[model samples]
Target: MMNFHIHSTWSDGLYTPEIIVREAIKKKMEKIGFADHYQTTKVSSISKKYLKMYLEDIKALRKKYGEIEIYAGIEVDFSPRTNIDELPDFEDFDFVLFEYVQDSLWDGYPLWMLLDLRKRIKPPVILAHNDLSRNFGATDIEAFLRVLEADNIGIELNTNLNYTKLGEFYYRLATPIFERVEEYNIPISIGSDMHENLELLDDVEDALSFIQEMHLEKNLKLFLKEVGERYER
Candidate 1:
């Protein structure tokens, strides 16, 4: 299975990058990624100066352990906590995750702002752990997804407990949006948002189940294709 969202010591997570990689291999995971925090405030995160070193650390692990596909990812807090104005191009990362987009509860920047920022970002971008039903439940679903498709933005099915509502995941709660996602060229990704928990390495099983139940396999493939293109470049 593939889990593209995770955290390690490069940010607020407890385990180091190598440790996370080793545990993922032990769990028989086919693919995984390190998506540590990249915020300016309210949390420990990767600053611009250490960004290159962070990518190199993951690069070394990819070479050391050829058993699994290791990807370098960053989770950008799309809120006031992040310095979006000075954000890097992130051309080196396999994929990018933007959390709290258009989330009023967190005072996140709106979708229009991210669209403007996307012009400068070359890598594939995914919306991380968002409550679409809460953020854009009133907006037209087709229009909302179309904007994402136009900008090449994907949505992440996160399995973190924090995102669950009365035992149902946020993605599950937003069934209306996901039900129609297949019709568009939008990509889909699954992640456990694992942090400080080794046993949760394979917690993405539920997310995988969601993809199959929703018939979003093609969307998943789209994301993999984007990641593969990065290798060719």
Candidate 2:
């Protein structure tokens, strides 16, 4: 399995990059990524000065482990209070994930602001663990689709237990959007959002089940192909 959202000591995670790499290899994962936090508010965030060190560590892991793909990424918290100008350039990273986007938690920034931020960032922008049903389910679905398609932003199927509600995952609550994802040409990103455990690396079984139930093989393949093209992996 492939999981692009992971955390390490560079951020709030308990394990270091080398330890996480070893664990991922043990799990026989096809691909894994280290996406440490980069938010301005979070204490776990990696500062701009340490960005080079984080990238170098991931680069070293990439060279050391030829059997599995290691992607270097960062997870940003999309909050209204965050100063977008203070964030570093994202050209060096393979991808970037934004959390609390359009959600009640953290008083997330509006979708329009996120779109504006996307225009400035160079890497692919993905919404991490978004409460799609709560956020987009009540809004104008068509306009939302138009913005996602125009900006080429992807949404993630986060396999975190907290996302479960009423005996179903949050992504399951957003069937309307997933049903028409193909129509809008929007990509779907899957991740376990492993913060401290290497064993949880690529543990996206629930996400896989959701994709299968929704018959999103075509969409999944499209996302993979787009990522490959974007990162030249």
Best by lDDT: 1
In model 2, the worst 10-residue window by lDDT is 224-233
TM-score of 1: 0.98
Clashing pairs in 1: none
lDDT of 2 by residue, 1-233 (tens): 89988888898889998888888888788878778988566657787888898999998888998988888889888885556767776888888898888787678887888888788887778888898889878888888888998998988898877777887778888988787776767778888888776667878998888888777777677777766665564
Candidate 2, residue 212: the lDDT equals 85
Residues 81-100 of candidate 1 have per-residue lDDT tens digits of 88888899998999999999
| Stretches of candidate 1 exceeding 4 Å from the true structure | none
